[model samples]
Target: MGGDRDEGDSRMSNLTGLSDDLINAMNRHDLDGALRCYTEGAVYVSPVGVGEGRDEIASFLGAFLTAFPDVRWTPWSRVVVCGNVLITQWVITGTHHGPFSMPNGEIIEATGRCVNVRGCSLRTMDGDRIAVHCVFYDQLELYAQLGAELVLPRP
Candidate 1:
């Protein structure tokens, strides 16, 4: 029983360590370093889009790097690790200095607005690498910070 508990703790520690490595990589804007934390066929899903593999994942994350060269993710609240999954609540702070693509396939030019948005993600680890990652955030909050107004269609 003690051995089993120890094993579980060890596994959680490893996953947390891997997650820290990923955050550090992102903070450094090291795309390759961040990619190393995932498996070749890892799937990343976010409000922005879904990336099925490393190349696609690169494009998905690279877009953020391009749009906010100074983007940084800081833990906004708690980080939970259970079994092989790690959940992180984080805050991203950056300036809109480059084009940002909207979910409607529209690209908004840089408005030079500073953005601080809260988000969360759950990453499932397969062995030491993340096999699946799901991210969540408020699109309206992000857009509002970029100075986009809500426009409703006429009924």
Candidate 2:
């Protein structure tokens, strides 16, 4: 009853704290610190691709940090948790100062464009660590902000 509710509340607090820590690490471009928030065998997925395990996850995130050296993630008003899952909406602001690789094996050289993109993530926690993290954002929004023109192939 009362005891169970207390435990549940404490668990929610811890999850929220973890989410904050992750965002802080990303804001600082602290790759190691960010990796520490996930389990050893964690899986991360985004529009770019999927990464399994710490090494793969590191590579995926490291690229973004490199491309956007001054990237910052600020929570966009809401962070909700239901059981072991945490959902967060965020805004990423940064300048393109390095190569950004595309999912289709193409690289976009630094356009020197300042980008402000809104995104969200869903994290499933296994104990204190994130076991699975999936991020959602519109690629078109990001690319348009970067001044990229979309070219359609003739079909």
Candidate 3:
């Protein structure tokens, strides 16, 4: 990925191995291995917030891994690569046996309940490493599985 390609080009690239390595590292609960997949300036965006670089990403993932010690992200769909970007649909499953930190600074203690949620990750590749990683998932689904009550008006 030397230069940026036009979005209208729609030509797909093959970066499956990069994503595979990352997912496998995460499944193995290897923080260092996962971190190595990203560049030092990589940006990881999630429902929580934006992780500007490797250190921030590490902290964010550290909390998540701590909360879900046995978490695993299983691919539910084929890997899609567009130019220098990679997308993967996944089903993450784990048990809540530790404290989970929320984006808004709230901490939810372990309820001993298991969670299985469908999500996706979009990554921008910079050669052999990821320059950006964005995560998508249902926040409500996670809370509902944990038995948290929330009332909001539908517009």
Among the numbered candidates, top lDDT falls to 2
Per-residue lDDT value at 126 in model 1: 93
lDDT of 3: 0.84
What do the candidate models score in CA lDDT, each in turn? 0.90, 0.91, 0.84
Cα lDDT tens digits for candidate 3, 1-155: 53445432333433677787888998999999999999999999998889998999999888888889999999876555556877889999999988986667678899899999988889888877899999999988998997766756799
Query: What are the models' TM-scores?
Result: 0.94, 0.96, 0.85
Clashing pairs in 1: none
Q: Please, what are the lDDT tens digits per residue for candidate 2 over residues 43-93?
A: 999988999999999999999998999999999754546779999888899
Better of 1 and 2 by TM-score: 2
Per-residue lDDT of candidate 1, residues 45-81 (tens digit): 9887789999999998999888898999997554546
Stretches > 4 Å off in candidate 3: 1-14, 79-81, 151-155
Better of 1 and 3 by TM-score: 1
lDDT, candidate 2, at 19: 93
Look at candidate 2 and give me any clashing residue pairs. Answer: none
TM-score ranking from best to worst?
Answer: 2, 1, 3
lDDT of 1 at 44: 98
